[model samples]
Target chain A: MATQQTQLLARTLLTPAVALLFIWMIVPLALTIYFATLHYNLLDPGSESFVGLENFRYFLTDPAFLASLQNTLVLVGSVLAITILLGVPLALLLDQQVVGLSIVRLMVIAPFFVMPTVSALVWKNLLMHPVSGLFAWIAHLFGLPAIDWFNDAPLFSVILIISWQWLPFATLILLTALQSLDEEQKEAAEMDGASALSAFIYITLPHLARPITVVILIETIFLLTVFAEIFVTTGGGPGLQTTNIAFLIYSQALIQYDVGSASAGGLVAVVLANIVAFFLVRIVGRNLEA
Target chain B: MARMVTTRHKVISTVAAWLVGFLIFFPILWMVLASFKTELEAFAIPPSFLFFHWTTENYVTVQERSDYLHHALNSIIIAGGSTLIAMLIAIPAAWSMAFSPTKRTKDVLLWMLSTKMMPPVGVLVPIYLIYRNLGLLDTRTGLVFILCLGNLPIVIWMLFTYFKEIPKDILEAARMDGATIGRELIYVLTPMAVPGLASTLLLNLILAWNEAFWTLNLSTLEAAPLTVFIASYSSPEGLFWAKLSAASTLAIAPILVLGWFSQRQLVRGLTFGAVK
Candidate 1:
């Protein structure tokens, strides 16, 4: 029995975290919402005025906003697709009986640990550089021209780098989920004349559904705000080719010093992320209840 | 079914998996190898895979050139300080929720998880202004405070999950023996919580170390962590492939090792125990 004394003590213990998180969540956000309504530019200070809905209107109407919005969706959608699609097969393969599984796993998952900047730059210079990158050499080996990655397809390049960073994460989670699958169930499927492909499609896919949702939601949360990789690789460069909402807001706030519009964009980002978080919290909460 | 797959099938699967693994890992591997090469060799067309003139010069140069150690120290201070502070605030809270969960415990935990979903960009403008006005910009304390708050939810959540798994019978038994609450925690609870605490620390440290948004926005040169420092190399310095590789390698090596060690915990931590 949880004594009343212990419950009191527990509430006391929880207060600091609760109080701090409450402030952490509410204070800046309240400020952001407040700032979103004003025509405040940092460089032209002391002329702040309430310009209700103007910032949001401008932020929403700006062509760059539309481009960055599209870019954000593409970045998130592509990385999610790439990671999940490849991750499933990779997880299945790793789940198979294999030699040096530990070493293979370490090598496979190594990229997930690499810092975003490092992975982005490494892929940019050493692997994808059109001039002297490894891909150039590989292209030369086949007597084909080197396709400039960042220059030609900056958004795709960003997507590739992010997908690489996240694929390992997807695989590791799915593999962990896979290892817990009922071997008896698999054997039964096999005995019932299910081929490997059918067993995987019918049994394995169903088994992976929850973890797949977990991976997608978790990855979407991170992917939607992907910053460092784009920052290092493209700097949202070549005229907003790779600019996502995060970078767009950063440039607006810190670069252009437009507090009002940046705050508006920030709110927009908050709303977008909350849409995803709504589903994620529900799913994770369901798991908690279970 | 396991026996139905022949040795040949096993061998084929092994080869394919290893190839895929190596392909996935090639970028990091190439970076490491490039770190050991002469700058010219690092960028040579028809690149030398293994026979390049190996050098430790890039590692020496990366430090001597950019003061790599300074940024690395900032990373350590920021990541370590945040994780430490987070754990201190989180431990008791997680302990309470685990041991004496009330009707609101689940709601509280879910609410904490929701805070993590608040995109950092949403609050970036205000936080930036707040830091500027308070003159906390480019300070380790600023970075540490933000990162600690940013990660506090996950720290509490992960610790809660771990602490929940800890059997309450032991605590009840200690209570039945007339042990005081403090003594019960000291003598009965902490030892069991160590593994969970360590893994949580490791995971949080890794997350904080690689954290980019706040560190990038709030700090410049003085408190710049490796993330910001490495981002500086994105321009002219990035063209120097070997040096870039050396800097990147050094920046990631510690977190990589820590990450590998904590990989198991990572799934639980990142997924908020949804997968587990």
Candidate 2:
């Protein structure tokens, strides 16, 4: 009876958080869905009417939607590839007995903490500006023409800035995974006359596999909705060159005040994100057991 | 277990690692240096690495022009307020789940995690409309509420992970000694949970501080935080590099320090204990 009472108390304790989260998750989502089907525009309030699937049709057929969709994929894919590629080697290097390991680690991780707006502005104005930027200065020394980063290649510049922010996350997680690897296993491989490269391929790489997947999934979740960097630097512009789905929806709602179509675009983003989240939740769920 | 390696190899690895570290850190270092330079010198050709005539004029000008302290204070309140509120709700939920876990506990936890996966953009339209109708747009209260909900899952999950590690034996011992539930919590659990609580607070504060999307979308001048403050510099009109750098530096410096201290908690909180 005492245990039963405690269990009831436990249920009571859990209710507030559960109720709040449920309301938070469901209400806005339901409204978004409801509005997606209406002819709602902030600019033309009190005129909302049922227009089933019209917003979706318009959003889907729009040229900007296709371009933004493509940009979204490329942005997520390229940033993931760059971070993981650089991160693996960086993690291995940090895992070694390097001099001043803490300082070096801190330096590498510093970029991750810089706010997206600061990093984006710093990159655009101080580093990537064609004539007065650091890259231009460097090019001048090398006798090469300066490339206007935002204009010449907008998407790639966004990727580079984002990759810098996320590289530390991947590296830090991979390093944690690396630190947990058993020394005896590597020693055993050495005893068996296995080459260093072969041992890494067989043992080390396998240990990092799970962390790498976790990194990829988590990064994908954030990367799909990269907003501030694009907002600050490119404004999704020089033509929809850098406008990922998040920026597209942002522009649609705030810039153009088209709530119905933006809601439709928002749903498309949700579906895309959910596909990634499904895999991520499964991975995290399995890890919960361990 | 120590493995023997040649001094030469170690030296080579150190050099290579530092080089990579410096390359990664250069942008932030450059920004900091640029903040101290004159407007004319900030955009100097050949980009003065360390030899620039340093000045505090940019910092002064940035503060004077934009009222940097006002937005900064907003950042503090919003980030701090949201984190405190989230912790308040999350602690009891996490405590119950951690200590008195039932058959459905795992599912409940996973479901909370799933809510985090719901993209903010998915609800952007409704939130905007709701805030507009309620006249809550450009209010710190609105941003705080949204940010709190946004981070509550991670806060609860982190607290759950921490609370679960506290041995149940202690609580049972206190119960046998005739301690009431309230007394048991105050006397026994609170002391053990303090460090975990501190780290969780630090990590959540950092996350909330750097949260840009909602803050950007929902806020304008009245309640704008550092993210919006820095973004206002995007439009180029004149020699604004030094001033922009000054604002950016001020915006990031506090959180960057907090972030460094909470690096371990960050990995665990963000990865949901998958990596750690």
Candidate 3:
């Protein structure tokens, strides 16, 4: 009897959130679909007319679309790989008993807290400045010529900045997973004379499988939409070398004010993000349930 | 002998870990140091580490050139207000989902999360139009509402985890003693889950605070947060390294200090169930 009452309350309480989320989804898609089918613009309503699939065709055919799409994939995939590679080892290191580990943990996580805009500026100006930046100074001291990071290696530079910020998150999540590993299982492996690397490979790696997926899925979702780094350092340039889909959409929506093309691009980004989310739901959604 | 070798190994690991820690932290350290340098010293080709002439001129210029305080206030108001409002809505929602069991509950949770998966750009048109229609452009209230909406699913998910760890029988006993639903949520559930809720609040504030895309797009001048404040430093007049660092330092100092104080709670909350 009490369960029924609680269930009814649950339904009532969730009604508003569920309804609002639904509206948020439907209204946006409806407007996007409408815009995609027309030449809608904030500047000129008089020129509006039905031009079905032209915007889509133009967007799909544009080289900018494919370039940004490829860049987006590379950006997301590369960051995911770097963060995991760096994060897992860092997690293992931190999980071990160490003096000043707390302080070290604090230092590592500090990058994640810095606002993206500020960090991007810091990197672009202070660390990647070919003449005046730290990397330049280091190179000069080693008798090597300085590399202009943004001009020469825009994508790689942006990836480095992003990976620096996100590595802390991966580390913390995986470290938490590491700490939760069964002590007995580890001890059993040790008693069997298993090397530390082998133990980590067999036992610890499997334990972290879920979190690694989560770290990738969550990071991929954000990375596909990386903007602040691009906005600050490269502006998706050195001739559109670093433009991701999100930046591409922003240029269409705001820079060009081509709402029709922008909406179509936005819809494409949504479809791609949802595919990743579907996989994430299979992993993380089950964890939430458990 | 074996114990002594193990002790030696622990020492080596500690030293190695601290070195890695210093390397990771060196960039922010460089920025802060740059903020104190004169522009010439800041832009020195060799990148002055400690031998540079230090000055407060960049900070002074940053203050004179930009409305730093106004942007800081906006960052606080928007991030704090949004997270507070999200907590208000999410707590009750999480409570219901946590204490109540249903076949559809997991589906509901996943659905809420699916909304997060939708890229913000996808809905920029409709949202922008709606904001323009409602006169919410460049307004704190609009930014707060959107930010709150954006983080609500994560808020509920985190709160649900925290509340689930709490045994439901304790709340039931409160009900048996004639505690109303309101009394149960406010008096019983909240206090018990304070740590979890606190971290949820902290993490949400951090997420909202670092948010750049919405804060940048939605607000040009009036509602621009610290992200915009930092972005303003970029212009065609050649980049000013010292001044930019000062601006960046001012933008991040408050949140960074807060994170330092609450690192333990933040880590614990984030890793809540993932490890265990």
Candidate 4:
């Protein structure tokens, strides 16, 4: 009887959080879906007529949409590739018995904590600036011409900044996974006259598969909505070269005040993200059980 | 098992690892170095690594130009307020779920996690309109509310994971000893859950401090945090590299220290316990 009473009390305690999250998730999302089908402009208040699928048609067919969509894919894909590729070797390197290991680990993980705006500006002005940046100084020393990073390659520059921020996360996760590798299995493989390359390929690579997937999925979710870096450095410009979908919708709703189309675009982004989220939730859900 | 590695191998790995670490950390190191230099010296060719005459003028100038303290206070209130509020609601929820999990507990937990996966942009339009109508835009309260909601799932998840690690036998023992629910919670659970709560607080505070997207979009001046404060230097009128660096340094230094301390919890919290 006492246990039954406590269970009811537990349900009561859980109500506030559950209720708030329910409203937070449902209300605005329903509003977004509703607004996506209407001709709503924030600037012209009191003029929101139902427009059916017209807003979606316009947003999906716009050339800028295609460009931003491509930019989103390229940015997410390139950053994931760079982080994971570099993260593997770096994690392996860090896993080795090295002097001052904690200090080195701190250095590697420092960039992940720097806020996006600061990192973007620091990279833009101090490091990637054309004439006076560190890259220019390095090029001059090597008798090479300085590359104007933003002007010549805006998306690539954004990728580099973002990659720098996320590389630490990948390294830390992979390093943790690496440390958990069964040493006995590796020793057994080594005693069987397996080469170092073969041992790593056979043993270490397999062990890393799960973590690498987790890294890829988590990074993709954040990478899909990388806004602050673009907002600070490129401003989605030099002719929309750096505009991803997140910035694209931002420009639509805030800059252009086209709420109808922006909401439509937002729904599209949500759909795209849900595809990735489905897999991520499954992976995490399975882990929750164990 | 300790494999015998040659001294040369160890030396090579050490050198290579340190070199990579330095290269990765160079941008931040360069920013900190430039913050102490003059405008001209900051952009000097060959980019002085450390030999420049160091000064605190840029820090003073940045403060004078923009009221750094006001924005810093806003950051403190927003991050700190939202975290405390979320913890208040999340603790009871997570505690109950952790201790008295029902048949639907996993489903509820997964549902909460799913809310986090929804892109902020998906609901940006509605939230903006709602905020505008409610007169919450550019207000610290508004930001705090949204941030708390935004991070509520994380706070709950983290606390739940931590709470699960606490053996249930103690709580049951307390109950058997004629302890009331309130007394059990106050004297027993709270003390035992302190470390986990502290880490959760630390990780969430760092997250709230560095959240940039909503802060950038929703705030202009009144409730602008350090993120907005630093972003204002993007299109400078004159030579302001030193001041920019100084401002950027101030914005990130506190959170960076906090982040390093919570690096272990970060992986577990972020990955939803998948990696850990």
Candidate 5:
């Protein structure tokens, strides 16, 4: 039996959360939009003036913007590719009967739990340092030159570190999906004399599609704004070689003290993320009814 | 012949899985090992795999030299405080949506999730400026406020999903018995909802603990958590490999244990119940 009292109570219960999130989302965003059109610089006070679209124009034309935009895309795209490609096989392997399964799963998933700064610094100094890193030592053992990771291929290093962190996430999701698969369906496939490869191509991957999409969308949202790894490892450098959009906006506002340009860059990032969010919201929306 | 083949198959796959797992886990394992070594041996060329003179000196040095406990305490307060507040705010909202179906409930949930998608950097400038003007920068209160808001959507979503699973029949049964609403919550609902609430709390705690952007941007020293504290080592001073390893080991050890416990809930919470 529906009652007006219950509905009113429900709205009352929801009011605080709704109102708080509303303010949290709107206030900063409104400020960002307002700040974007100004010539605001924290360093030089009282220089604030209306500079409509000039900040955007400068930010759009800046070489750092283009490079960072490319870096952001490459970082996101490469990590996605690596995680999915490796995750599928890893998930499949884990789904098999294995001794010490729990321990293996823990070990496999351990890196995702490591904080970004710790992982980045560890990889930088402990394993990737040219002169003394484990990788260098291993190369030296083979009578090869120690390849400098951060200096030589900073973006690649960042990509590799992030991929390591995300691989566990992809694998864990895919594995969960794989575990739920009907055993009878797999048996039915085997009875049809389906080769393992064919069964995987047909039964396994198709079952995995939804979860894979979930993994991709969720990971993309986080990956597109990967800041901590870049912050600690390269500081967006060797030059601007490893700067992503998130880090780019950060430098503009905080380091360069250019709020107007930073706000514009911030909106650009919001637009890019919203494009991904559009698809994600649709998918999650569809699932809400289920 | 069939049994032998099955055994062989399991053996080969297990071996392969272990190899890959070890490879994936090698970096973290190597770091943990380095934490146990002396400064000279931490980054020594031809890195020692085993049989090194293990020492606990780095751990002691890291704490004594750098006030590790202070940052650790900050992490506890910030993460713990945010999780508690988010849970408090979210539980009511999630409970209402779960119990009372409205035409707009779906829209509200999706809208909330959309807020999370707005990249934090998009609003970093305003937040920084606002915090500065309000004198909230470098304060645990500011971190808690921001993080609580940031994670509220997730908390609500997770709790909503969990609450939705509690069968409506039981609550109706309790209502029909003339139990008051408050009594119904305290008696019937709380028991079943406890697991969901706990999991959501654990997962949100982990997320807040590792959050870097706002913490890094806003807090300098007074309120820097282990994330900021560990990042401080990334400067030229990061050359102290043993100390870095020791600090990192301490930083991740608690969360890793907590994370492992909450892995199942993590997938559900992170994916917004999309996969589950």
Candidate 6:
């Protein structure tokens, strides 16, 4: 009796949000599918024609479409790898009982809260400018030529900036996980004459598995759809070198005025994201309980 | 020999820690410094750390170049308004799930989280159409509604974790005192959960403030916030380093101050569910 009542109450409480999101999901998707089969362009609004799967066929075969899919994967993968590698070491340092550690923590987390566009702009202009940026300044200081980060290396530059911002999140979570490690266990390990490196390998690394997974999953979801960095840094280019899937879709709809193709592309991106999200759901669901 | 090695290890770790911390913070520090430089001095080779001529000309130029105050105000309104709205709805919902949860409550929570995992671009087309059709494009109201709805799940999750620790018997006692549901929520639950709520609010406000995607995509002139304001420095011709820094410094200043003041609460809030 209690179980049934709670289920009903749960449904009642969750219904509003679930229903709203369901509509939010279904309505766009329905339009995209409907539009995909019909000829629709923002430029040619009055002319409507049923064209089944032609948009998808066009999008799939488009060279830019293929480049965008590859770009999205590269961006997400590189950011994930860099954040974990940098973040784990950073987390270990922040976990130390150093003086002024509190201030250090705040400084570390400051970047994560900077608006993405702002960060990208800062990186592009102040840091990465070939002639005038601090990077240019530094290379001159060392008597070397400056490299144009956005022009020559737009994708890597985006990856680097995004990882820099997200590094703190992974670090903070890992720091929390590190702090929760039992002092007694560490003391026993020390007493047994285990080296610090070995102790981390045997004990601390295992403890951090969950947080590491959480960081990767959460960051992946955000990174796959990263827009502002490219939007600000290179506008996804020195000619599509940095255009990820999200940027590709935005450019199609807003810049190219191809609503049908963009909708078809959006649906494809959604399906790919769902496949990634299905795994994320399993990982996140195992931990969250009321 | 062992003691000497330990001392060396300590020194090495301290140096490494400070070096990494400084690197992580260098971009922001560079922006602040660049904000005070003249455009020519800002571009100087061998980067004048302190020897360059100092001027607030860039800041002045930035202020005169754009509507600084208006973008700042738009940012404050959208971030503060969305966070406030999210909190107001989430608190009650989180309370119900935490204290009076039914068998399906966990499933509901999981489902909410799953929505967050879906790529935002997936729904962009339809939402654009919705906003366009409803005349909500480039409006603060539109931005506020989307942000609140977008972040509701996170707000609820954070509050639910905090609310779980409160004894159910306390609310029961308030009920015995003939306090109404609203009174119990406002006076009883709100007070008891103050730390949790305050931290949640602050974090959400920061997150909302920094959200760039939807704000940029949906907004132009009248509704565009600081993110767009900063992005404007990025031109198709090339970037202006000094001016961009000026805009970035202006954009991040308020949130950095908020973050400095609320460090402890932010730390505690971030660590709440993860540590457990």
Q: Which digits, one per residue and each the tens of the lDDT, describe model 6 over residues A238-269?
A: 78899999999999888887877888888888
Q: What are the runs in model 4 whose C-alpha is more than 4 Å off?
A: B1-4
Best by TM-score: 5
lDDT of 1 by residue, A70-132 (tens): 999999999999999999999999998899999899998899898888899899999999989
The TM-scores, chain A only, for the candidates as listed are 0.98, 0.98, 0.96, 0.98, 0.98, 0.93
The fraction of correct interface contacts reproduced by each prediction comes to 0.82, 0.82, 0.71, 0.81, 0.83, 0.54
Give lDDT tens digits, candidate 3, residues A1-290: 87788789988877777777777778888898888888877677678888999988988889999999999999988899999999998999998889988899889889989999888888887888788788988998899999998888999999999999899888877887788899999999999999999998999999989889778877888898888888877889977799999999888888887889888888899999999988977776566656
Which residues of candidate 3, in runs, are more than 4 Å off?
A: A1-5, B236-239, B261-276
lDDT per residue for candidate 4 within B90-122, as digits (tens), equals: 999999999999999999999999899999998
lDDT of 4: 0.94
Please identify model 5 stretches exceeding 4 Å from their true place: none
TM-score of 6: 0.93
Q: What TM-score against the true fold does each predicted structure earn?
A: 0.98, 0.98, 0.96, 0.98, 0.99, 0.93
Each prediction's RMSD over C-alphas, in Å, is 1.3, 1.5, 1.9, 1.5, 1.0, 2.8
Residue by residue across A169-206, what tens digits does model 5's lDDT show?
99999999999999999999999999999999999999
Which is the better candidate, 1 or 5, if ranked by lDDT?
Answer: 5
| Each prediction's DockQ against the real complex | 0.83, 0.82, 0.66, 0.81, 0.85, 0.51
- What residue pairs clash in candidate 1, if any at all? none
- Model 1 has a DockQ score of 0.83
Q: Report how closely model 2 matches the true complex, as a DockQ value.
A: 0.82
Model 6: per-residue Cα lDDT over B44-131, one tens digit each: 6667787778887878877787868898999999999999988877776787788788777778777777666667776677778789
lDDT of 2 by residue, A1-290 (tens): 87998999999999999999999988998888888999988788799899999999999999999999999999999999999999999999998879999999899999989989999999988989999999998999899999999999999999999999999999999999999999999989999999989998999999999999999999999999999999999999889999999999999999999999999999999999999989988988888887
RMSD (CA, Å), candidate 3 to true, equals 1.9
In model 6, the clashing pairs are: none
On a 0 to 1 DockQ scale, where is model 6? 0.51
Q: Write down the TM-score for model 4.
A: 0.98
